[model samples]
Target: MRPGPSHLDTARAEIIVAEAGHRAAVDYVSRFGKWDARASVRQRPGRRLSGHRDELATPFPPELAPVAAHALVAGRGPDAVREVLTHSLYQYLHFTTELEELAVIPVVAKISRNRSGLDLPEAMRADAFKIYTDEAWHAQFSYDLVRQVERASGIAVRLPELPSFVERLDAVRASLDPAVRGLEALMFSIVSETLISSILADIPHDSRLPKAVRELVRDHAEDEGRHHAYFRQVLHAFWPALSARERRAVGPLLPQVVLAFLEPDYRAIGTALSAAGLAPDEVAQVMAESLPRRRVVDEVAGSAGSAVRYFTEVGALDDPATAEAFEASGLLLGAAR
Candidate 1:
């Protein structure tokens, strides 16, 4: 049968209506449905201080916590931002890839449990999916930024693969048994999100990086705020069930892992700086002084601030020993100011 113009117009009109309805539905879901419960849920408790203080104050081998508190404080005024941006862009690419790979863990676990009749909330599921998507986007964004920097400055910044932090996290998760996945989830969510968020906030808005890079980082910081909320909720919700030993294990590991991520591979930095027209010795001086300050700024602004808040919320920072440790670690010195 040959369709007339009227019939074709009718079909087109129906398609348009359907598309509009779909768009409206998506907007409503995003704006209202997902956020309805947020107001009722109080912000998660802050990190506990007593145990954390001891862990931070404890003497460790040089490699374990390489950069000292004094070093970070002393290095602040130099051209630290330039060095950090170059190094961090490289680090972000590596970490973003790891984040994507880790997304599979929750997906598989959720699906398996669903088959057995346990179901996670649709909103939670949606948020998880969004994280997976964000991770990939962030990776590409960082790669693009790195490429642009190279193009603009005629520099080559090559980053090696990060050893699988996510895999190690999963192994830690597995060792604890399924009953304690919430703790592992808490550790992952709080530590990882807070760390990166703090760092992003610390980057000088007036830095030499292009507007595009700044916008990308700003957007990432917003997304991380939501992620931090989710983890804080999870931690508070599950705190009563966690054992003393489990809590203790988490305290030390948080700072250790956070510090581990801070260690700048100077060789990589040297390569990037040399490509940017600096001599090797010049790069070395910049790194030895500036890199540590940048690391402190990144850590404090992103994750450490949230961690401190969390501890305060949870009443863990009450002990004198914990307070001393925090002081010694110098994580809190002039950070909020």
Candidate 2:
């Protein structure tokens, strides 16, 4: 069967000419692309406490992760509790870092390798290379930090063979209609970058975290602020080029991608919790209670607001199927449970 005309096919020529500059992104990176994670910072005492306590004890938020939710785990004493949260931070950061290199870099490559596919300015293409380089370094810094924490804390990070996120992403991509399967991967990764950017921006300000930890997060955030803007531009520029059928195919999947990216893998959580001395059943119980579906929806929904708004603004939400999908995914009014 033949695909219908592009949603923006009528306007693609004008859109391309108008968006070709992507000049702000180029200028931003050129001016502020400072600091190399591996070489930019000095060694610290690897102190666990930011000032009085480890900020990681709170991680995402009290309501979201709530590591101390279980009656027994809550009473595990401050030391044990801190260890659990720290472990979560380590595993979560590691997973997100891997996503950057594995998923994000590939999206940039898709365009860089094909000018027609991207229909972007040369400056934007050049910036793609910079992003590829920047995200690679981000991954390296994350890996190095995990090892440093493990060595210093003596708590081995025994993560599962594969990060649950990668698995979730694969599952989502597979579930997508074949016509839009490829777009799913790239969009999911882009959306995840938006989510991670907010976290990286704030984690550095956490005085309760170790100095090196803060610096690591700070350095990464600096880069991501640039990336967040870059991807937003990409989304703005790319959406207009898609066919209406492609939008229908791609839009409904946004909520799925958002949920997949936002929800932590409870199995991974349990594994980390068990590694922190909790028994299997206890880990299971905590995981079950701590991440109820409602809580997950709320947290994920809240974090996904900006990305959702972006989609709507870009006319990705103009279709009924897309709006319905968002509602069903808890990203719109009267969302599904």
Top TM-score hit = 2
* TM-score of every candidate relative to the true structure: 0.55, 0.80
lDDT (10s digit) by residue, model 2, range 110-148: 656643344555556666777777777777777877776
Tens-place lDDT digits, model 1, residues 1-337: 0111111221121111221121101110122234334311221221122222222222111221232222442255223334434444555555555554554335424422432111223444445555555555555565565565545533245555543454456665665545434555545644565454433564326344344545566656655666666555433322322344444445444444444344344555565455445656666665676556666545444446666566545544454554555555555543353
Candidates in order have lDDT scores of: 0.44, 0.65
Off by over 4 Å in 2: 1-64, 196-198, 333-337
Q: How close is candidate 1 to the true structure, as a TM-score?
A: 0.55
- How many steric clashes does model 2 contain? 5
TM-score of 2: 0.80
